[model samples]
Target chain A: MSAPKALRQPASLRLVSAAFLAFWCLIAAFPIFWIAVMSIKVPIDAFAANPLDVILGPLTKAQGDGLSLLGIVAWIGFLWLTFRVCTRLLPALVSRHAPFGSAALGWLIAALAAGVLFVLLGFGVLVPLVRALDGALGLEPLIGLTTQHYQAVWVENAFWRNFVNSMIVTGGVVTVSLTVGTLAGYGLARSGSNLAFWILIVALVFRALPHSVLVAGYLPVFINSAEILRPILGDAAPTLYGQPLAVIAVLVAINQPFTIWMLRSFFQNIPADLDEAARVDGCTHFQAFRWVIMPVMWPGVITTGLFSFLLAYNDFLVTSLLLDASNQTMVPAIASYFNRETTTTDQVEAVAAAVSITAPLFLLVMVFQRQIVSGLTAGAVKG
Target chain B: MKFKTFAAFVAPSMFMMFLFIAAPLVSVFLQSFYLTQPVRVATEIETCTPGFTGQVCKTETKFLPQLDENGKVITETTFVGLESYRNVVQPDHAWAAISSFDWRGLMNIDFWKALRFTLTFTLLTLPLVIGVGLALALAVNNAARSIRGPVIFISLLPFIITPVIGALSIRWLFVGDGILTRLMEAYSGQDIAMFAQAWTIELLMLFYRVWHVAPFAFVIFYAGLQTVNTDSLEAAVIDGATRFERLRYVIVPHLMPLIVFVALIHLMDAYRVFEEVVGFRSQAHVISLQWLTYDFLEPDDAGNRSISRASASAMLTMIGIVILLVPLLRKTWRDHKGAH
Candidate 1:
């Protein structure tokens, strides 16, 4: 492929692109960043230090040192200007290839930006860490950073139970959906009948069906099932309504279509000759799938499993409707923090719970970023 | 393959799908035609009261659930035949309100209100999500290689987060005394209560929807961008086409099918918006058809649920989705046939 002339073009375009990317990066990162920051601050401190006020308020009257609010605001403004300059102007200057220019100036600007970032990080994160450590060490704490909210959410509010419930539900749904869906997808891929085509089409339509429609149908069935089972199981009958299994079943049902769609394509990519070769060795079809196919299908299975876990873990509508209070998953459990009956004092704890729920997913994205990107675009974009 | 082998392979999935998906669909349709209510009977009670002359006997009438021989209350499910649909759409009431020029009355109907919001929300956000997603893809496409991976991972964060949590996060930013809200107040010098009004809440919900889902579109467009033929791009570039022109002529056309794909997914998903309403707790101001169905299913103080109404609403929501999906499905069918 020849390099497009635009790639060798003016530095201005690259500068603009850099700045534009930086702006979007900030937009994407700020909310989570702000949430993380606010999660550590005391409730009063969190609400008091408004961004606008911090940027524009008057300064003075310090206890430790007489630093004016103006000083802090000015420092922040200077950092902001420096960041903008480094991202926008310095790129153009460096890319122009002037004498003693590109490499040295680029390094200089990077160092400057790094310095500013360190300062911002110190104020935003490190200070809080130090304060928490100070409190733990039985010393005078200069800032408010306590894990009491995390404790309150985990212990007093019983979010630990909800977290465990979410794990069980997600685990069950992912396992069941992948196991059943892979088999179905393999069958469809290998079949010569037109029924397979129609089934795929039908599954697509089912995937498009609103979750509420299905949940509405399940409502009566589950209720009746519980009623009928009461005579046999007595106290255990609540499992139908108030258990992870019911939620897991519905989740798997809803998730199967996408799982099958993804896996069908994955199976299609493998050479059919390999399976035939296995069969020639006196291996049964299931045995071929088990030994020959499954080994090569690991990557696809992992991708599908990730999505299945996401579906079960992230779902709100079905989980909230199907599972009773004692068995609610993390999404619905965190939402319960906002219920009208809960006191306003629990707001900080609610934020903490939100952070708790998001932490694992953030880690997942970090660890499996490559697979996730590929998995997301796999079905939508085709050659 | 033998039929028996195929059956053995496919039976589990088919059974689950049939039981859960097909059966419920049929039940929802059937339920739309029936009205399930408590069986009621009129009973008379004679009472003796001292009046001016002597004890006067009076009879009082009361309606109560009729009981069976075993003393269990029986629920009567009568096949009302489209009555539930009529009750929801309220054709007569709508016409009356329209003729009377009662604008408020027209909006007062829960179905119309929900329909209005649903249509507006779905239609309005479609182009924005597409546009923003395309822009991000373009920008990230041109970004330096070292930064590209991290940018994508960051962009995907919003899409990957749980939908409910994503909405809550944004809501927290703009709710009472939230960081963004406080910032706005401090900047504008006025208290801006974001969730207090209908339009504000709707706007926030729309914004949140875009923020949460645009990453999905970005990932799709970015993938589509990779497959754009480089020879065509080089030819366009050699022809002295500006970046915009190249994108307009060469790039977008290549990505057209993917744009349609994303649109189909978005329209189907957005038309049945429920999670946002639940997450934002905006049902009082902006209820959707999906929420309406859930609302109907919620048990009343007497521990009785309006299952018939919920089923009706569910059926209606499905019809709306089917209507939205017809064009896409037809196109897919045509393409399938063409391939054949």
Candidate 2:
């Protein structure tokens, strides 16, 4: 097509477009907005009677329509400001004292925020919707909040135990998935042809199975394994049946495929000549991978690893079915607290559990704010 | 040395995959076929008669013989043909659906409604996600460093965060008494039950879905945007093309491959639509095929009748979606192939 005349624009137009895009982004990121606000509101103020009225500007209960829209805007602005202040200071803290420059802390915080943001999404959104039906027809939340839901959940060694269960499950899956997916991806990158195509199809299909079926199919096998596995390391053998290991096993099995597919795409981006150069320099292929290829693929590996770690940690169905009641993860605990009869005080804790689950993750996102936005979509645009 | 070198490079991951993945999947498929066999009975029937049914059988008719008082044979139950599969296929025949009262859920109205609700939900959500995703990709891809990192990070945070928190926090935000509704009531001057109203719920669901996936959309498009031929873009810019013209004739046409790639991934994930809907839907039966599969697997007396029907429904949804998107995927991929 031939060039068209340019529209004359002042520099302000570009600035306006930037502002408009930022505004749309804030709207799209509603939970993140709710999160920073909820974090600081002091729980009592968060749920005080007539709680919605407290928002600034047009959001006073006196004016409802413009109130909500402005409330949303105000909420977004509030959260962005917090992020700005936090971001500005964090690098300073790290740079000023290099000794505390712990890289893993960023990952931990991101995971925590992931847990927090998710819980807020569910309770702030799902349970209330269910309860609203009750309210609309003159009813109450299905499981209203209570101090007891938190108490019941907290007092139960089971609930705390499940958090450990999830960690083990997520950790096992991540380790196994990365080990296998990375290798398989490397294999595919070097393979001659069509098997790679078939494998990619397999990777995608497994990535897409409803875990309900996967877990259901697993139940009987696990239940029946007591007799056969008793001999392996004796009756005390870390049985796969109902263990957190079972949950992680399925997760590793299910999730490994996708990263294999993703890493394959990025692995291809690594030049073949790098391996040749390493060989010419007299490094064995093993040395080449350890010294060269693996390091080159580290960023891809790290991104893929982080994604898989989050997926495993966030998963509900696999962990729930294979795990016993005492073994429930954060998702199931959050679901159970609401689904079971909960009182209002318990409701806050349920929301608390939700926030606590993803809080560290949000912190991670703040740290990696640079890499995530860049590579987050990398697989999609190319793969 | 080179061949051994290549072999060495690939060993660890390959060994791990075989032991963990291929082993389990093959083993599970084999196991799904075998029901838990009762080589030895847990308890034999106590006495002179056959069986009663439902609540009556195990409680009231407990002591009857393998043959009931009526002498109808009762105690033993064993392997049946894709009996579970058959249940979902001919759901009417299986006992009333196990999930609802009185078996009425078998011909699940809630299931179908959820399916329909999901359709409308996806229709509303996808555009917002894709639109916002692409817009961010275009705008940020052109911006300075000051605005880029933070904007894209927050934009993409929803995608990277674990779904447990991500999904729930989102649900909480728009809940009926949620911050969103409370704000809506204050702003609108009329109390709107954000989750209680159908249109409002639809809007809320769409809004959350967009927020949840918009990051993915932005990330994918941004990734593609990185690969764009800047020289090609500069040539168009130098030629005096308008911004819209550049987007249309230059950027969009150029990003066709990425667009198709984004659309395919979104279409696949969107139709699955479980985590988002599960977070949002509790009141009205919002029908979607994924939820229907979930409903099918809810609970049955003997075992869940899932394999065929759940797979069947999923397969059907996939087929339907593919049929719809095939032309687009093909047209876009084909057009963009040689150029990329």
Candidate 3:
């Protein structure tokens, strides 16, 4: 539809707005883009005094460690293919072949399979293929690109263990919080009692609490947990401090309030008529929620799940304070790299690790942009 | 829904929240009033060490924590009502500095220094984020329809990236001849160090937070813009209103509630600003309330933490947030009552 005559913007206004938008987008995206570029080059090139030298990486080329034109093309093609497959083909395949009651289960399996496939293709097939092509062509390097920092971070420094720890923590947090939150949110949404309103008010207050206070309270108890559990479990009781389970528990608690609030708003958007009809058809309350409401709630669940995943994945204060050195998550592990004395190579590795952690987030945003945006506006617009 | 079923449905969530959040809050409150310290006893010991000629034996008296039979340190806890808070606030020292009008002296105190930066960071970034977010929304609204998706996708990157990582990205760009610092130096024909001083570091922090959060506000405002009454806008234009007049009168008034919502969320989040302090390694030059608590609780070489002080600091931080949130809470309460 065309804008009304008065609503249409003048050319100058449109130009200014476009320019402002371009400037804002650059301010928003440039740091991420620059960091990814810096992570691939050698430290000398990455941290060069001249921005052009950093980009061109002549010193890296002189060091004989840079990507050829063919190598760059292969890498881009592989990444694009992976993105397309994971975002489109995989989800479609999972949903189609999934059993009637197990689509979520199917998606989980598919996601894991896709992850494994990506690792295998990138490292197993593509690395070797690129090396062979570059060797055969004997072409000059086009731009600096090195995986040495990534290799050091993931292999030499055992950063994969941290990545695994992060997965476990985030996974547990999202699963538990979503399961609990959906129930509470639905209950609160359907219940119009004074008690429900009070509960929600309390939850809002709880949600505003800074996490440090919670960590402070948990610290002493966790440190002495072995003794606390000794009477029931005898001498076999384990200390809760520094365990991934402890971090998960704390994160789930921290995330519950916001989760319930978001899910409640989403549940309210779904008319009560649907579930009321189910109830009239002889489905019990629980059954109505299960067989009728839940299927329609998947979009909302997925959106809330994305947020829970981000909170648990991106946490620093709780993980850094509570987790043991061996059980540190990716964010805290990267922070630890800067805590101690470090060489130029070590700093570059930290940058590599930083870039690696953001890859999963980038993919999530790419696939679920609409859901994330809607979820953000849902509360403000409706409530 | 019946009360019985509602209780059953919410049982697990309530239990977890009560167990983790409510109990911890109570404990933190109580802990602030109590101090725990290891019992120290003076003991005489002889140490023999290798010297230049022969083994040297020296006798010395040392005060060390007493360990129990199980190899755990013996500790004592005492009720010291409000003492920890006093220690944290340092009322006497603060009063002396204030009476003398020694602004620098007051800032030399850790808590005051942190409070200064935290408050300034929160308040200064508020308007900038709202302004940028509104401009972005208006821009995107007026843009060609085909490009809005790409523009939004690119803009959301800063919001979704981990906060600490975002801070680190800015830190890397400007720390020690990084790309931005080099560019500025080249343009100005002078050397620059962004992290060397307080003001520059604080400025970068404000910029980073605004960049990180404006997208969230933008998305909200953009959604709000979609529902703006086009009829009113057309009428305003017929009335000979300029573009600025239209925005100020029509668009902004419509987005007011959303602005308040964004402001409330920003206040709650920004008051606890700890990540930038950690990510930028700004403890030497700047700190925040949350960082102060963490610092107090961080173990030193002796494996001792000032748990009471940390608790007190945490309580203070919570109180500050509650104070800031009081107005919003009151408004919500009134709205709830009206709805009822």
Candidate 4:
């Protein structure tokens, strides 16, 4: 016997839940908020470590000297919590008989209100906090908010090349994993063979290893590949080290087992009769696969492909290992940036870098949100 | 199609796996056995193979025992069986141990301590990742489908960042004169040195690490949540079950497989943590096996005692994972069975 939803619903229950949600959302959005705030600060106001001063014309050291960035963030966090609690509490307390339209309208108004509050905090609380601290500490902030960070982050040849590198590697991984894993999956799903099971286990083992350890192990291969290839292919031996293809190979290999598992599930849901029917119609196994099985597997393939791309694109340990100094990925370069000497390092620039890198992919996920969601649930729910 | 033709259709991919994945992996294990360095292996190959016409290779697999006691040459050559393993376990043997104050002690911690910390890091990270992660996942899942992609993408940003960058950013967040320090001093009129206490430092590191990684878990969990039986929830609710009960009886059981899988991944990753450890640079060291490997790279930092301890540590870590993985795999297998 479980507690009824109505029975457990204390007057403050919604309030607390809403508050927790707000706090989590605030925590989640902190870095982005900090970045957007720092972006608007004048050069002198953003870089300073403390005694930060806000520049709205002439600036004053932030009032109530006991304020900390954590406190400020905490304060904002509390405010968010308050807003969430009040809205939920008030709405529930106000009326049970309110029209559905009125309730929906209330919900929309609250959401919009929350959105505006967050934006204001990002602009209002965060910027001044960074600025006033800089002023108080006598540290010069990185002056002027501009599109330079975005331009530098995305417009640079390195960024574009890295993007291309990601595409190539990720594409290769998806292709290889999909093709190989699909066939293996077909065997695993159709025959339910132990070999397929074993294959999947091995693939999982390989993929599951600390990627860094795998990257370290791969050092030997990258180092020795030149020699390994020369004898077999002679002078025309295609150099593989630091090539996007290497990443592709690694991604394909890493993704293979997972792909197999996913494809197997997708294939299992598909009736063998369909496969059999296609076979009876003068279709060779390959022909039937191309004409029959491939189409049915589209949903799985699309999901897997997107995942593979993201994995490859985001892969740091491997890229850091295999890629040379000249060919860094977005992740490693950002990782390495802290080691570099920046002229008045803007926190916002770093934030902007973070944002720009994630924005495109996030948008893609947004656009095809249903597919990703379905993909996750699809595998899990089958159990 | 006949079974044989089906096999034919599968052969290309299988062959590719065998040639590329299986063979290279095997070769890595074999390389571990060879006596010489990687460079020596490559260079020695062309001249040394007994029968090969192409690149031939030879190795001095035996050690001269002429150095009787502390290199007081009074003996002849002797065959050493698995001495590397012996040497690695007792890092005090073979090479003068790394004792450099600046660089030593990263990897050269007792094999046991390193193992303990590795497991601790994994266990510590697990709840933070899964609990908060599940919440984030559910939130994003329930968010307007319009924002789902954008929110998820933003959330997982840390995952794609190189560990170096990820860890560095974390360090920046908590270090003295860091955002946290600045923030704390402003609010409480107290300076919080994040790195002074092991637990304090560990907590911060744990928080940052989980923050960075939870999104990956979120994405996966969110995906899993979508496939959960909505009808079961409706039924549970109609039958008067609350959210907590519903989650436990219905949603949780549904998510068990992913939970196990995610845990397994985090376990493996935590054992070999490196880039972040270096970046964090806290005084209270949560030494991991990787630190040992990195220590070996800069020998004489740990008194050049020997490479034995580090190697022993590495081997032991592998063995531990092998030991722990069995039960976890059993659970996964059982769940996998039940799921199907």
How well is each residue in A1-383 modelled by candidate 1, as lDDT tens digits? Answer: 44545646468977887788788778777777666656655566555545633222222111221223333444467646654554455555644653331243343344445555645774576555544554566553233344567788888988989998998998899878888988988888888676787888899899999888888788877877867688888867664666688888788888878888898888888889988999999998888887888777766787888889888999988888888787888898876788842543477678888888887777566545666777878788742
Instruction: List per-prediction Cα lDDT, in the order shown.
Output: 0.78, 0.59, 0.89, 0.59
True contacts kept of each: 0.68, 0.38, 0.79, 0.18
Quote the B-chain TM-score, candidate 4.
Answer: 0.67
Best by lDDT: 3
Where does model 4 sit among the CAPRI classes? Answer: incorrect
Q: Which candidate leads the pack in TM-score?
A: 3
Q: If the candidates were sorted by their lDDT against the true structure, best first, what order would they fall in?
A: 3, 1, 2, 4
Candidate 4 error regions (>4 Å): A1-8, A36-44, A48-144, A150-159, A341-343, A346-355, B1-3, B37-114, B133-169, B195-200, B212-262, B268-275, B278-287, B290-316, B329-340
Decreasing DockQ order of the candidates: 3, 1, 2, 4
lDDT of 2 by residue, B1-340 (tens): 3345334534554454455555544554443333433233234443344547533333233333344567544433344545434433455543455444544454344444555666666566667777877887877865776777667666766776656566567666665556766777778888666556566656655666677787777777777777778677678878977777877987777677766666666666666666655565454535456656555545457554443344444444545555655575466447545444
Docking class of 2: acceptable
DockQ of candidate 4 (2 decimals): 0.17
lDDT of 4 by residue, B14-76 (tens): 675565566655543443444332111112223365565675565544433334456543422
Residue-by-residue lDDT tens digits, candidate 2, A195-253: 45555555555555555545545554575576567777577755465677667767777
- Candidate 3 has an fnat equal to 0.79
User: What is the DockQ score of candidate 2, to 2 decimals?
Assistant: 0.28
Provide the lDDT at B55 for model 2.
37
**Deviation of model 4 at B244, angstroms:** 6.0
